[model samples]
Target: MKKILLTGATGYIGSHTALEFIEKGYEIVIVDNLYNSDISVLKNIEKITGVLPKFYEIDLKDKQNLEKVFKENKFDTVVHFAGLKAVGESCEKPFLYYKNNIIGSLNLFELMLKYSVKNIIFSSSATVYDSTAGKAPFFENNITGKTTNPYGTTKLVIENILRNLSNHKGLNVVNLRYFNPIGAHKSGFLGENPNNIPNNLLPYVMKVAIGELEVLKVFGGDYDTEDGTCKRDYIHVMDLADAHFKAFKFLQNSSKKIYEEINIGTGFATSVLEIIKMTNEVTGENLPYKITDRRAGDVDIVYCNADKAKKLFDWQAKLSVKEAVEDQYKFVINQNNKNK
Candidate 1:
């Protein structure tokens, strides 16, 4: 069994991936500062997987403590997921994003080199792609230097650093450039729990349905699309987690010391209005929403051509948009029941 080092292990995607790894019989060592997540998620993972992962409450920015974690455990692969992710927050505080995302990643990489752990699976975003460059359904070969926000810039920078390290430092790096990931696990015991206000649509919609938020603020309704709203490829969170497992297995046995990027998405575009409709269907509530002006850095239509992920990892999103929305609704219902 391979021992995996999962940074940001308590966060939304990280928590689900931990469950996936545990289910696959891999020993997981989790490290997180709980900056954008909760410690309660550890309990949730244990509840579902029946095994508690070895966790260290260490921040990646703290090189001394991070090194201590490396000295304690033997990790076959590192799934890098620790970073500040909100685009608006990144624009407001670019320095914070740079320090946490870039500097923290630098700390992790330096420690990895010292510990002789080379294989890594980086959690990346489709924001690295310049949607203005071409049509929708972006592929792996797409030119992606241009990004709209500092958050996206941080991901691009890390990808470049990993690319260089892989070539010169004998590192095996696979960057999974994911599209919009929504939904919760089937258990509803684990899901996205954003610290502050959610910038994503699905979470905001769920909050509105549960009466936590007043109204779902639809960003833009005048973009160049079928419904004049932004279109994105929303994949289930479990599917995204499954892709990480496949990537880890591929890296473990492969002979080539390669640096590669895979687009992880369903390759199907769903519009904002369509998402609203689907969420309403699942929640059984016609929640209130208002169409507003376009937010800065908002793209019209951005999905991915995930042919490479299918060919390379034999992975593709299996859940439909309706199913993803239903999972979110189920999670909200479960949370409300818990609070009561």
Candidate 2:
């Protein structure tokens, strides 16, 4: 079995991916700062997978501890999930995004070079896509330069760094550009755990259902979308997890010359209002919502062209939007009562 190192292993996506990797018979070790996540995720993962990752609780910016992890264990590949990920918060504190997302990642890359670990799969976001371009879906070959927000800029910058670094023939990198990741593990034991207020729509709707928040807030209902609101392709977190696992398979088999960037999404657009309506259907709750002014830097409509994943790795999303919401809602309610 290949030994895998996962950063931000206790995070929303990392937690789910950990379960998938463990099931695939990989020996996993994790490193997380716990800035916006809790250690209890390890327990949930152990319960679900019967194997807990070897964990180190330290900030990614801490070079001393990072070096120590590389020295102590042999990691064949790394799937970096460690970073600050709130869009609205990233705008307010752009430096934090750069430091944690970019500089911190540079530290990891340096360490990878030192340890001769050349393979990496990055957790990138679709926010790097050019939303202004006319399209039903964003293809892998689409000209994707104009990113809207600081969070997106950070993702784009890191991907570019991978491209340049790979040119040296020492590293092979895969940037898995993810769409809006929703849903929980089918067990409902692991799901999106936002640090504070949920920035993503699915988590926000779950928060409302769980009584942590009062109502859903639609940013705008006057856009040119089918529902007059922003539309996004929300891939299930589990499907996102599977895509990462499959991408790793491709990387493991490819020559060192391969450095690829692929999109992971359902290629199905769901509007803000449609998300709310679906939440009501799945959770059997009457949702309260009000249309407000559009949030700054939010794309009006964006779906992914997920064909690349199918052609490249035979991976595509299998769960529908409603199935994703159902599992996510289960986690929110279960977590809400525990907090109280």
Candidate 3:
């Protein structure tokens, strides 16, 4: 069986991708710091999959621990998903974001070179595109240098680093630029369990529906869109997880020509009001939300052109928005009951 080292294995995306990889019969050894996560998730993953990956609570920033993990595990591929992802928070503390996202990655890449693990799949973001340039359905080579936040800067920088690494005779990669990742596993056992306030729309709406938070604040309703709210390409987190598997397969015994950056998201775009309405429909709760001032760095519209991913990996997002919202609503109910 092929083995993979997964950094940030307890994260919103990494946790689900771990399930995807395990389901495909890959051996997984995970490293996570649990700085912004709960360890209870490993139990949930075990409950759902009946297989627990070897877990290491090691921060990627600690070069010593990363070196130890590399020395300890013999893996064929490394999926790097450990990074500070909150856009607003990245702005407030660019140093923290750079330290965790950039420097931590540099350390991991150096170790990958040391250990001779040349295959990697990076979790990139669509925020790297300029919201002002061409329309939605963003292609790979469009206005990437115009990101409005430090989070996007980190992703872009990592992509550049991975490119440089690919120059070596062994290292080859696919930088998967993710669109919006929302929803929970169908089992209601594992999902994007954000530790403090969530930075995305789906979780915020779910909180309002569950009464965790009283109101969903819709930021900036004056945009040029159908509903005057921000438009985004929201993909199901499961789809995102599955796409990683496809990309992994694409990387399996492939030509060097396959080393490229790809976008992974649904081509369809949804607005904030549509998402809120979906949440209400899924939860049977008419959530109370009001439009407020636009948060700085918030894009008016952004989506991805995932045609290349489909062509490259024969993978397309399969879950509908309704299905994702339903799963998320169910998971929130299960979570609330567990807390109670």
Candidate 4:
């Protein structure tokens, strides 16, 4: 079994991917600082997968402690997902995003080189694409580096660094550019539980349904789309997890060093209002919402052409947005029941 080191493995996508890897018979070690996630997620993962991954509470920016983890575990691949991800917060604190995301990634890459861990699967974002450069369906070969916020800038910079490393250092890198990921594990035992107030749409809508938040704050409602709202390609978190697993398999079977960027999405666009309506339909609650002004660094429409992922990894999203909404509501209701 190949040993995989998963950074931020207790977070939403990382935790789900850890379950996928463990169930696939891979030995997993998790490293997380618990900045935006909880430590209890490990217990939930064990409950679902029946295997508890070895975990270390170390920040990626702490090169010394991170190096200690590298020296302790001989990992075959690293799946990097540790970073601050809120776009509004990234704008509010650009320096924090830069220092945390870019510097931490550099440290991890340096350690991977030292440890001879040549394979990596990066958790990139669709935000790295230039939203104004083209239309809705963004392809892998589309123009990038015109990011709207500091969070996206960090992802683009890391991709460039990884590309350089792959060019000269013979590193195998796969940058999986992800669209909006919303949903939970089918077991309802694990899901996205942000530490603070939620930033994404589905989480906010779920909170409103559960009466944790009074009303959803819709970012914008006067865009050029049909409903005058921003449209995004929301993919199921589990499908996104599967993409990581497939990418790892692809790397393990590769004959030579390669750097590939692929988009993992459903290729179907849904609007902000449509998401709220779906949430209401799934939860059977009138999810009250108020549409405010347009947020800074937000585009009217941003979806992806996911054919590259399908062709390369033999992977495409199998879950529908309505199904994702249903799964998310189920998880939220289960959590509520557990608390009660």
Q: Top lDDT: which candidate number? A: 4
- Assess each prediction's global lDDT (C-alpha) against the native: 0.91, 0.88, 0.88, 0.92
lDDT by residue for model 4 over 152-173, one digit each (tens)? 9999999999999999988899
lDDT winner between 2 and 4, please give it.
4
Q: TM-score of each candidate?
A: 0.98, 0.97, 0.97, 0.98
Comparing 1 and 4 by TM-score, which wins? 1
Assess the local accuracy of residue 50 in candidate 3 as a C-alpha lDDT between 0 and 100. 89
In candidate 1, where is summed lDDT lowest over 10 consecutive residues? 278-287
Backbone clash pairs for candidate 2 read none
Q: Quick one: best TM-score, which candidate? A: 1
What is candidate 3's lDDT per residue for 98-190, written digit by digit as tens? 888999999998999889888999999988888778777689888888888889999999988888878754588899999899988999988
Which is better, 1 or 3, measured by TM-score?
1
**Regions of candidate 2 where Cα sits further than 4 Å from its true position:** none
What TM-score should be assigned to candidate 3?
Answer: 0.97
Which residue segments of model 3 deviate by more than 4 Å? Answer: none
Off by over 4 Å in 1: none
Clashes by residue pair, model 1: none
TM-score of structure candidate 1: 0.98
